[model samples]
Target chain A: MLAQGLTITISVLIASAFFGYLFAFIAGLCRLSKNVILRKFTGFYVEIFRGTSLIVQLFWLYYAVPMLFGIELGSNWWVGVIAIALNYGAYMSEIVRGSILAVAKGQTEAATALNMSRFQRMRLVIFPQAVRMMLPEFGNYLIQMLKATSLVSLIGMHDILYYGDILRSSNLSQAPTVYLLVLVFYFILALPLIFLTRKMEDISKKGVASQ
Target chain B: MIEPIVTFNDVHKSFGDVKVLKGIDLDIKPAEKVAIIGPSGSGKTTIIRMLMTLEQPTSGDIIVDGKNLWKMEKKGSMVDANEKHLRNVRGDIGMVFQHFNLFPHMTILENCMTAPIHVKNEDKSTAKQRSIEMLEKVGLGDKLDNYPSQLSGGQKQRVAMARALVMRPKVMLFDEVTSALDPELVGEVLEVIRDIAKEGEMAMILVTHEMDFALDVADKVLFLDEGVIAEQGTASEVIEHSTNERLQSFLHRFRS
Candidate 1:
């Protein structure tokens, strides 16, 4: 059971970061577009995902998208993965947009004076700055998505939470220790991300200082 | 005059209802250093911004080497040139702002090489060598690996100048490049600009607040007032003995 839970956790991490980053990149680009119509189009999608609860989004993906589309979404654990990525991708889009905007205007102007086209400017100049700006928030989201995997267990996915519950039912005496272990397990994953956030902030400060 | 490297013909520009440049007719001779100076809100900076193509004119045109830039292609009233053509036009010129807009993510060397590699299509070795030579000329070869934030304001501005110079533009526009620097740091950036201007083969347009420097270095001085050139002459006439009372009163502030 412990092994099964560990494997699932690893899969969750892979699925979320991979697809979350993919959709997030697209959504981020859409948001930064100059065309007001395109920006509004992306804005609507982002609001629907971000403003709603992630759990509800996950539930919709797991139970509803298939029914609405009339296609079979087989239960191969990919449902949890796709659901997490789409949900988190929307939330990550704002972080990406804000960071891209936060980059200094002069940088874009410099690229302009160099005669780089808009695509070249964003690809070479703006996106690099945006990625750096998004790193801390992305790390935070990764940890949050990890914690969110616990919810998938309630839907019959065999995650760590499921193992904890099983252990609790089989040996009631170990409930306190088992729950403490779960807490410690989450903290172990989350605490490193917090450390990484501090490290990045420190690096940025030092980078400025060195400049 | 080398056939009017740049010309502004009755160029009128405004932001919404607030007009910035009203009928700014001017011609920049190749390799001439002209300084534009005025009280705040006098539209001195707008002239340079218009030349840099940062702002578009609401009416009239800017002709660069005989090319009318403001005239976009029209097929039954559909504008075709758009931002892409403007980028190509901008390549023939360079600008340095009050804030040294260096690429913070890149090293100083990369900042200098970006245009040469991407725009000019120069080889990596040529770009690297030129960037090094430019940086060394600006006394920044030692700081090539440093980011803009790691450098002093003066150092960053010098890097900015180097970045523009590396492209070997036909014209360079400076909008108060030293205005944002410390009083002490101002000299270093100015000294570099003076050296470039003195080379006497580069067309340079300057918008500056330093009256003394303008008088010393500028071949001609333009005094702008209320979106028009109130008075303009050789360095002596405008800076030394302005007959205009408003210019005189404006100059009085410098005395204190």
Candidate 2:
């Protein structure tokens, strides 16, 4: 049962993290777009997701949204994934926007003098350097998003925390041991993310260094 | 008489209320090397910047190769140039900046290759060969794989020159290119520019403070003061025998 619970947890984490990053880059670039309507719409999306609680979002999507709209989502799991992705993506997009802005203005000027089109300038010169700046902060958000996946159990997804709860309710005497194992499970899951972050940080250092 | 390659007709520019350029007229013949000498805020840098399209003229016209630079024909009438139009007209011009704004992530070779391959749509193998040739000419032949951070200021400036040269612009503008270098390192960058001026058929406009270097290479020299050409003549005629009081004082300060 615990193994099955871990599978569900990993599945949700992977799916949400993928969509989260997709939303992040799109919303982030849109935030800097010259089009006013696009900039305002993405700004609104970011504010709405960031302004609310993730747990509230998950609950609303899973329960309240279905009743209010009188429609059935394909699966309860999707609701959890969408909530986590939207919430975490909004937070990460700020890091994206700030890092892109932080790249030296001279880089843009140099690209312009080379006769690169505006799209080519951003894609080849600006975004490559901006990605290096975004990596470390993005690593932090990835790990945080992993921990937030534990909240998905409340929406009837059988994550590790759900299994732990079941074990505790069945044997009250084993409650402390059960929760202790859950903590260990979370730490173990976070270990690889920590390692990846260190690797990304090393690469960013080489890209950013100057003599 | 050969047609002039570039002409500026009564151009004016102002940043808010401060006028940087006022009623400027200039002309350059093909392969002519012109040096502009002036004090700060004399609008010397602004002249080349307007040519490079880095800044726009507040009024009047810049003609490059007989085409208006800041205006395009739309519906048989001249309208303010758009990005596409500016880029098409600007393709004939190249500039070397004072700060050597090399892209930090790309190696020196990649810096030279990027614009040719991406902008001009040259194939990779040909671009690589041309980039290597240009890098060799600039004396960075072996440093092709090195990033900008690994290079000294002089070497970085040379790479900047190579990057501009690979495009083979009809007119090259050097905006105080060596002003950011250490005094000891200035000689190497200037030496490369001198060699380029000797070999390339491109018209060159150099805005510089080095009077000796100005006289060494420039065919004509202009002393700009108070947003106008105070004096213009051959290098020796203006640099050595000028009778303008303000230019004499300006050269006096430089001498000391």
Candidate 3:
């Protein structure tokens, strides 16, 4: 039973992290764009998603939005994924913006003097250097998104915590054992993420050193 | 009677009431080398920056190769040049910075090849061949695969010169190119620049504190003071025999 719950939790974490990364980059670039409309739109999206509660957002998507559209989502899984992606994406956009800005002004001027188009300059020169600065913050956001997935249990998704709750109710005498095992399981899942973050940090540092 | 390669007509620049360049006018003929010398805040670097379109002039025209740089034709009326127009006009010019701002993430060869392949749309093989040749010319042929961080100040500046030359610009601007180098390294970078000037087809504008190098390589020298050309003449006349009080004092500091 715990095995089934762990599978669902891991899947949601992976999917949300991927989608969040994509959204973060798009929103980050939009925020930095010269077009006032795009910049304003991204600003509004980031503030709305980041300012509000994530659980409320999940509830709105799962319960209210589908009803308004007159379509049945049948499961809250999609809503859980979407809410996690958007909320974390909003937070990560600021990280992306800050890292991009931190790149030296001389890099941009050098690209301009070379007569490169704006897009070419960003892709070839600026983004490559900026990504090095973004990696550590991005790793932290990924792990935070993993922990936040436990909130999906409130909407009836059978993630890890949900399974632990079921076990406690089914065998109340073993409630301590069930809860303790669940804690161990969460630790097991989180430890590897932290280890991977360290590994990625080392690799990125080496990459920059070689450069 | 060849046309001047660059023209600055009554150019004025200011930063919120602090005027840096005040009504400056000058012409740079093809294959001519002009050195601009001045005190620290006298706007020597501003002229190079404006020519490269890194900064805009407040009010006047900068014409490069007959096209007004800060202004463009819009429905037959002259209007301010937009980014697109600026990029088009920027193709014939290149600049080397005091800091040798080579892309730190790329190898020297990649740095030299990037602008030519991406901006000029040269084929990969041709760009690579040209880049290798230019790197050799700048005396960095052995260091082509090395990153900018691995190179010394002088080597990095040479790579910068090679990177700009690979684009084959008709006009080059050097903004205190040797200022950031150590005294021992300054000679190698200046030697490379002297070779580029002697090759003699591209118009060059150099802003430098090396008065002797300026005298050796510059065809003409303009002494700028208080945001205007205080004196202008051949290298010997301006550097050695200037009568202006501001220029004489300025050169005296460099002499000792």
Candidate 4:
């Protein structure tokens, strides 16, 4: 039961993070783009996701959305993935936009003077430096997204907390043992993520230092 | 007679109500070195910036290499140059800033190679070879692999000069290139500029506070005051023999 729950949690975490990063980058670029329509659309998306509660968003996606649209959204799994991704992605988009803007204006001017096209300037010159600034904040968002995945259990997805609740109910007399074991499992999962963030921070710092 | 490489036709620039440049007309022949000198905010730097298309004129035109820089042919009409048109013409011009704006993430070699490779579509090998040659010319060949953070201000400025030169720009604009450097370190960067001035056929416009160096290196000097050229002549004539009261007072402020 624990293994199945861990599998579900890890899968949702990885999938949401992947999709969320893509969404954040696209939303961030749209926010920065000169096109008014794209800017407004992405701005709306960000505000809608970020302004609402994550649980409300999850419940809406899982229940209200399908009913309103009269369309089946495959499974609770898909709903969980989309909800967590869109919620976290909206928050992360601000981080992405801020980091990109934080890259020195002089860098852009230098690239412009060199006659680098806008694409070349962003890809080769600006983004590399901006990525360095984004990584630490992104790591924090990753952890936040991990914790937010627990909300998926409310939507009837069999994530770790859902199974932990089940274990608590079945063995009410020995509930402490079950809850403690569940806590250990979560700590075990979180340890590597925290470690990975640190490792990435070190690598990026070293890259800058070596350069 | 050889055509002038750069022409400013009654150029006027203003920022809101603040007028910066007023009815300026100038022509720069190929291989000519013109030094612009004035007190701060006299619009010395603005002239170089306008020529580089970093700033646009409020009225009139800047023509470089027989093409109008501020206006571009679109369909049948002349329109303000867009980013594409600006990029198209920007290749002929290069600028070195007071602050050496080297891409800090890149090595000195990469800094020199980036523009040529991306803008000119030169292959990596040829770009690398030319970057090495340019870096060597700037006396930074040994520091090619070093980042801008690792270089001194003088070295970084030299690398910047080399980076600009690697593109073989038809016109070079130096905006107080040594003003940010240590007084002791100014000579090395100026030495590199002097060498380029002697060797290249590029038209050079220098906005410098280094009056002696300007007089030494520039073929012509323009003394700007209150957004107009108060005095203009040969380097020695303007620097040494100017009778214009505004220029005399401006020069007096710098001399002692």
Is candidate 1 or 3 superior in DockQ?
3
What tens digits encode model 4's per-residue C-alpha lDDT throughout B1-256? 8899999999999999999999899989999999999989999888988877778899988999989898999899999999888888888999999888888889999999999998999999999999999999888889989989888999999999999999999999999999999989999999999999998688899999988988999999998888998889899999999888888888888899
Least well predicted 10-residue stretch by lDDT in candidate 1 chain A: A202-211
Model 4: per-residue Cα lDDT over A14-64, one tens digit each: 999999999999999999999999999999999999999999999898779
Off by over 4 Å in 1: A35-37, A204-211, B75-80
Tell me the spans in candidate 2 whose CA falls farther than 4 Å from its real position: A208-211
Q: State each model's TM-score restricted to chain B.
A: 0.95, 0.99, 0.99, 0.98
Per-residue lDDT of model 3, residues A1-211, tens digit only: 7767998789889989999999999999899999999999999999999999998888888889878998866567778888999999999999888878877888888899999999898998889888887787888888899888999999998999999999999999999999888878877898988988887687556323211
lDDT of 1 by residue, B112-146 (tens): 99879987899999999999999999999899898
How far off is residue B55 in model 4, in Å?
1.6
Ten-residue segment with the worst summed lDDT in candidate 2 chain B? B86-95
Window of ten residues with lowest summed lDDT in model 1 chain B: B72-81
The superposed Cα distance between candidate 2 and the true structure at residue B91, in angstroms, equals 1.0
TM-score of each prediction: 0.95, 0.96, 0.95, 0.95
Give lDDT for model 2.
Answer: 0.91
Candidate 1 CAPRI-style tier: medium
DockQ of model 2 vs. true complex = 0.59
lDDT of 2 by residue, A1-211 (tens): 5666898889999999999999999999999999999999999999999999999988888888889999866687888889999998999899889888888776777788888888898888888888998888788788998899999889788999999999999999999999999988988999999998998898787655222
